[model samples]
Target: MAAVNRVFAAQLAGLPVFGPDGESIGKVRDLVAGLRLDQQAPRVLGLVVELATRRRVFVPMLRVTSIEPNAVTLATGSVNMRQFHRRPNEVLVLGQLADARAELGGVRVTVADAAMEPTRTRDWVLAKLAVRERSSRLGLGRRRSSLQVVPWTEVSGLSLGDLTEQPQGAGQLLMLFDTMRAVDIAATLRDLPVKRRHEVADAMDDERLADVIEEMPEDDQKDLLGYLAEERAADILEAMNPDDAADLLAELTPADQSRLLELMEPEESEPVRRLLAYSSDTAGGLMTPEPVVLSPDATVAEALARIRNPELPAALATMVFVCRPPQATPTGRYVGCVHFQRLLREPPADLVASAVDTDLPALRPGATLTEVTRYFAAYNLACGPVVDAGDHLIGAVTVDDVLDHLLPEGWRETGLHDVRSADPMKSEEWERA
Candidate 1:
């Protein structure tokens, strides 16, 4: 009944899901399969679609109208909104099966991909597996591993006993994460089992892991860091935003804080240590040491260029600080700041000092939470500069950080509901089937 009779599970990933009227719904994050106890091919259960609100839900295969190369059309827009939880007999194909060890024709191989096709009953089943030969035991005379596709029934070790509790690599999981935002990736990790979460984190590089860590809730952040070895944990801390790293470290015991700080490079640890010196509820504690700063003599074009960095957060790119001598924080005299809007109106070659906005007063490091909020409201500013007693720029606080502190504890976890509930289909719908 579908437009296509066969579809590769990997190709379905990241595809935009649409409703019958061509309305956009969500994107496919992974495929759910029901493993058979008799070693038969696993049945295709449904799709894990991440909605616009970042909530992931299940869409049964019977509701999927077509499996095209670029899109998956749903039979109807009215679907269950319950959060997806893997049942005892189910497994996430892309998340847990890819890179899993298996045997084909008595030869050991690794699952690289899988394919599903519709049977006469309109039920989809995992019919084929794309596998690669395992590398040689030793490095002496290793050759490139060859890849091939074989029937799922012929592949051993795909049953529930083989994959449900066994450790698997994250090769395919990382591929899906490559296209997601850091925040989305963090949310996805929160939904996975603790062991699986660590597997994915262990496979990630320091910089990428740091980005994901910064987006996670404080508790999850601390938990993941603790799971790593001391050296690797220190590297992750070094890669994180200094203020964020400090916040996470503050949660640990004082002994741990000192040990991690010692392991970090001196230059990298300096700002974090300085942040730790301040009270967590103060402006100095909430501000980030890495802000866009420029010397007074720099041109408007240069100021704009600095903020143009794709990696810079939207709030941090709102303006550029103009100081006297040292361009970095704790610089010379804190002259003033140039708003991003002002840079566009000024001549390219004109010095940034000419366009500086000096009317707004700077925030002191000791400014309380109430004082910071009042300052933001009074000035209608999205970001404010932090200065020491001598008027030296120390850091910049963005509105996002302020909101993070303002929100109640465990706010992130509160929004997520992970319960196993009954099917939404009515008795009438079931009777028709």
Candidate 2:
């Protein structure tokens, strides 16, 4: 008799599958599991296999005669070649569970991968998970150095419901949504039920939620903010970049906008309020109020240190604005900006003013979208400072914000921004029209 076999979901994926007569089949694309309310662990239904023809088919677990490290053997050489369709009660393990977050013994952990085992009844069940833990010593440089295999009963906060239907439980989904970008998480949340979406949002900290909210579509942004408590919503808005916060608030009713603004801290709400005063299509409306600003007298080394801040957005960090006194808004007459490249090429002791690009034209707050786009294209600029009539720098427009406005409506739903190629938890949802 064949030895009892068990393997992790991650290991099982991509393993070559064969027939009882030794004919080659295809590879395992995903594993389907049936959620059980009474049992913490779900039963493994079967496999979604991809054939040589690039067609996906469902092969029941009963047909799986032997499970080995290198391959899975079936009971017979034949398999039903019908297109795989997820049943109403089934969830895709690799598509949805891998990388999901779980809470074990009051400690939050990530499900880096999962495992399955056979019972006495000859049925395979999702039995354990490989949870990752990072040492705190690394701080921002933290890496998954250890993985613990725990029974499914020790985990919580994952939605095990049918992927095509309403999700069941919620605490965290997919390793704090690890190996996935914020925009991708927002896109996935857009497809979830309102309650499920809210659950996922609630599980995240203010900063992470703010990042996800900023990437969501306008309608989804409003819906999610509306679902949150007033104080909670205000906090999230405060956490987001002023430009993104203002854009989201602009979509709400005047009264709703006023309420959230009132609840926000004065310093955080001030810039957003100013941004809201501008027309949506104007340079002022699209610019982020926060950018790295330094005195022209500062050394290149100081400027480089400021840009190294982990919280600074990539686009905004590409250049440092040189300003005079009144360091806040109306940043004393906009002297000029020094590109990061210049800082790298110059001596650390050199004053930033020496490297300032005064020739680059500053954008007027009232400049139209077309004019701004032309300005960027003409100057080959990735970001441009916004100034008032008196040449006081108020904010900056990054290339990303400009592209967000210029892209077609419902661009997030399109696969143009899909990060699946880098995401290990693969799903075919983006392939749909």
Candidate 3:
């Protein structure tokens, strides 16, 4: 194997770990480094190897025989199977240090990566940082951030300063798992310590955070929201689905709920406020105020284009509701709905109104959970519309939401491990050192 004498922390992630005899172990999920009191580089502690069981364990640096481009070879095949827990002085290199802010030559920069090298005594230690300069504050027409590598001691803010004041790093972490599902991200967040979790969450954009929060359990969602600044929390809520946002808000104290709602824009908070007015078990509370609603004049091509949005949930994209006018939720005259398959069969130039399916009954705002469940089952529907007494299309209830309510509490957390541990090569993968 080609040896890796000097490697960036981010580069080590996902590389498979192997024993001295070339038996496969686990993969490198992260590197643990023990911070020092002075300017010296932090001592490299170990590799956080995640096994096929989805359990992570620490493999000490001393046990690593060689670091190759494709794998980390260990000194022995025997390993400590105990779960890895971060010590007080140790920090996850890629997880907590990447994307950190610092000063390089009197200019502010963000850490893109960190490099580690072994000393004469044969101990690995962080030695250099790859940093990208922040954009010009003078509105200089979108200059790209420039990257540079410097000795770790030259940059300020490299040390984990006051945890409360320090900006958390998550760029590399997000990049490594960019393709992960929101549910998978939520599961990963659950594994982090509270402080670390908040740091990671704080680094995510409002829309991304909203998606991940929607998949988390109610208690986890509440706790994470509480940890964020009230303004940021409100912004994230605005980005979430109206029903999920309302559900999360309903769990908070009335005063907290009122304050957050007040922070949100009037237009954004209106649907959420309306949903909160209903009992949590009712259709009004379960349905998302934002459904695929198009005007009767909308052509099949337009309807097809709307549902094709990558961000739209599969359940919500299954059908589009046709209304008279004012296509937004609480739309005019609940005319009828058209299934996606029907739109596919019709000509693109044809009016969507001609293909509407008005025979399926719409549920009322006060429909009980059981009634909603039966409605979906009876019609074999993935999505059903919720209409008001005046026959105004108000919202949509999807099968996924129904499943969330019907499943036992803590179901997300219960199935998280199993979802992550479903590898067919469980026996073939073994850890070393």
The models' CA-based lDDT, in order, is 0.85, 0.78, 0.83
lDDT of 2 by residue, 266-294 (tens): 99999999999999899999998888899
Q: What tens digits encode model 3's per-residue C-alpha lDDT throughout 1-433?
A: 2345689987788788888888887788888888877878888877888765556777778779888777888885345565566766777777777777778779888888889898887778899888988755757577767678889888876666633256656776788668666875776677566777887887798999999999898889999999999999999999998999999999999999999999999999999999999988888889999999999999999999999999899999999999978888889999999999999999999999899999999999999999999999999999999999999999999999899999878777554243332333232133221
Per-residue accuracy of model 1 over 349-395 as CA lDDT, tens digit each: 99999999998799999999989999988988889999899889999
Q: How many backbone clashes does candidate 2 have?
A: 5
What residue runs in model 3 are displaced by over 4 Å at the alpha carbon?
12-29, 33-89, 99-111, 116-204, 411-433
Candidate 1: where are CA atoms >4 Å away?
137-143, 411-433
Model 2 TM-score is 0.67
For candidate 3, the 10 contiguous residues with the lowest summed lDDT are: 424-433
What TM-score would candidate 3 get against the native?
0.72
TM-score per model over all chains = 0.90, 0.67, 0.72
Best by lDDT: 1
Query: What is the C-alpha local distance difference test score of candidate 3?
Result: 0.83
Provide the lDDT at 110 for model 3: 88
**Model 2, CA-based lDDT:** 0.78
